[model samples]
Target: MNPIVYAIPIFFLMILIEVITTIIRKKDYYRVNDAINSLSTGMLNVTTGVIFKLGIYTLIYNHIALFSFDGNALWVWVLGFLLQDFFYYWNHRKGHEVNILWASHSVHHQSEEYNLTTALRQTSTSFLFSWIFYVPMATLGIPPHIFLTVSLLNLLYQYWVHTRHIPKLGWFEYVLVTPSNHRVHHAKNRKYLDKNYGGVFILWDRLFGTFIEEDENYEAIRYGTLKTLRSWNPVWANFHLYTEMLRDAIKTKSWKDKLTLWFRRTGYRPVDVATPMKMPDIHAYENYNPEASKGLKVYSLFQFAILVLATTVFMTISHNTPYGFNLLWTIVLALNLIGTGWLLEKYTGLIAVEAIRFVLSGATIFVSNGIWINLIPTWAWQFIIVSGAVSLLVLQASGIAKPGSNREGNTVRAAGS
Candidate 1:
């Protein structure tokens, strides 16, 4: 079995344990709403990462046969880990410094809560430039398998660092990426900004002039981007910066300003706009309304549960199956996840959209089983499964399964309120 595939269950189980412990210990920071929001977004990010990785692997196979490089020596693994860390430091540092890279990396920081789930809240778009940072390792002749394994290891190592529950380990903070140092890295506080860009070794940050130790005077870490995502919409969370950049590009009179906005510092407000638009500060609305209506909670949780199941099934199929149908499954799963997230965020016209999805799912299943079963490849069956699951999710999100009375009342309330 692939180590990554094995690691998923273990990772989530660890998160579950942490959640339970947090509850029992009476930590007020364990926010279920935030967890749900983060998990939904994180799952989407992981799906995006998988798609990006597949494309990168294809490129590696065609252009750079790093898979054939010598990796038998123990030193090779050590060197690969160290080299990957060095590159990761730069990749991470640049992610903060550059606008385009920040657009890709910003998803990870969108969560206000610091926990194990936050570690999974990675960027889907990193595949575009991330590979560029690691190419030096490939050119240095690290075998592709070794490089890949070490990269995963480096990522897994960073996972435990993304929590507020874990305090600074005395001497450990000096050499390794600790929760304390990482918290500082995530903080929006001026002093902590763009510091501690290490995957496995904090020493690199110290050496490279990016290290900032946690300071009590700086106050509690304020998570998320300097400019916040005001909504829980996963699509907007992923693409907001890109959209903002595009908007600025179009509105600006100068082509140079357009190009500069894409590459320039994040939050570079252009001058000479007739009126400057103020972005909403989501942090200002941190007060939670009383628990949502019980019926809405149940409905949302049911849809959320379905989304999780569909994501797991998609991941399993993607890992175990061949590339052809896996890509199809991925696209379907991504759409399903996004759709469900949209529903959870209370987007308009969700019910009507999901009803159509249900009809389409039934049609596809019947057609595939009746006529196309014999003609299609075995992997194609997996694609059909993914499609059906996605359609079911869409239907649920659209409120096709919701009680008629509930739908009518919701509509009335929406109209009246």
Candidate 2:
């Protein structure tokens, strides 16, 4: 089954429930714009993985089928689930403990608000290490497709667990990864670090000694990595850990510490350093008081609604069209929305960005429709291209659109220490 196709409607329904629940609880936790941005990046990550996954699966299936073995055992399917979860537990745990893995996993942890959308904040580089964990399953004679399907199912099951709006489910907590358990996974509190490493099942973590239960004494959970990502740049969020590690390795005097920083532990504090850097206490900081400005809240909400609508329209269109053109357009649209939001958030001249995006969109649509090439003269394409370039330059020169006193800006200035 195509998990993406099946997961879309279910995902939106979950989001609806989360939004309604947040409203009833009088909490502004479900920021629709943020969710849309995260989801867009996450989808891009998954799409990037598809090519590698298909290639790997094909190679393994073709090679392994040559062996004289039964691949259709029901027990094999069951074992595939168990084995995949076990490997995932280790992969997830190492993602916290190893800087290299953390580079890929940090995308999920970068979001400060834990909700259904956070589940979509997946790493684009996950495929780099994901295959390593599943190789054991392939050796056990499970067909590649079965292994892939079960792995995806395990991932799909994890989406609901990202939400804080859902509370603890007593017995379900033991058997499966609940919102309560996974909330602990996202928490940066001392007690919650490296806990709850399960995918669909909590048993793996329980058996592996990585599980930590919720503690009321820890206070309300704070989301994000220990080294908080201070930027909203999705590309940087995905690659910052790697860049930091490389820089540290290059600067360090000791070869051992340099190597260890990448392979040994995530965001490791080097003892050999002349000066020790202190990690930020994200939990110590007070939450942004959105209540201070009712007008700003209303404007943010309006922008958020538009973002959600845009995402839905693109996703719906993506589902119906063939993968080639549809996928290309979907990415272009998603990036445009993300770029727009980023410009707005950074207070980086929104009009210029919008104008550039408008020209790009127009050129793409015109070329895609074969209007200039087919309907217009050959000379018109050159004119259209020049016009598009000029439009982009004009847009780039115009700065971001600032909201009036009626608008609360998206800039998140840290509260007093």
lDDT of each: 0.68, 0.66
Q: On a 0 to 1 TM-score scale, where does candidate 1 land against the true structure?
A: 0.80
Question: Mind giving the per-residue lDDT tens digits that candidate 2 earns over 66-145?
Answer: 44345577777787778788888888888888878888888888777778888988887887876776666665556776
**What would you estimate as the lDDT of candidate 1?**
0.68
Which stretches of candidate 2 lie above 4 Å from their native place?
Answer: 50-54, 64-72, 253-260, 269-279, 286-334, 366-400, 403-417
* lDDT per residue as tens, model 1, 103-184: 8898888776678888887666777888888777766677777778988899999988877777779999999999999988
What candidate 1 gets wrong by more than 4 Å, as runs, is 54-69, 273-291, 319-324, 347-417
Winning candidate number (lDDT)? 1
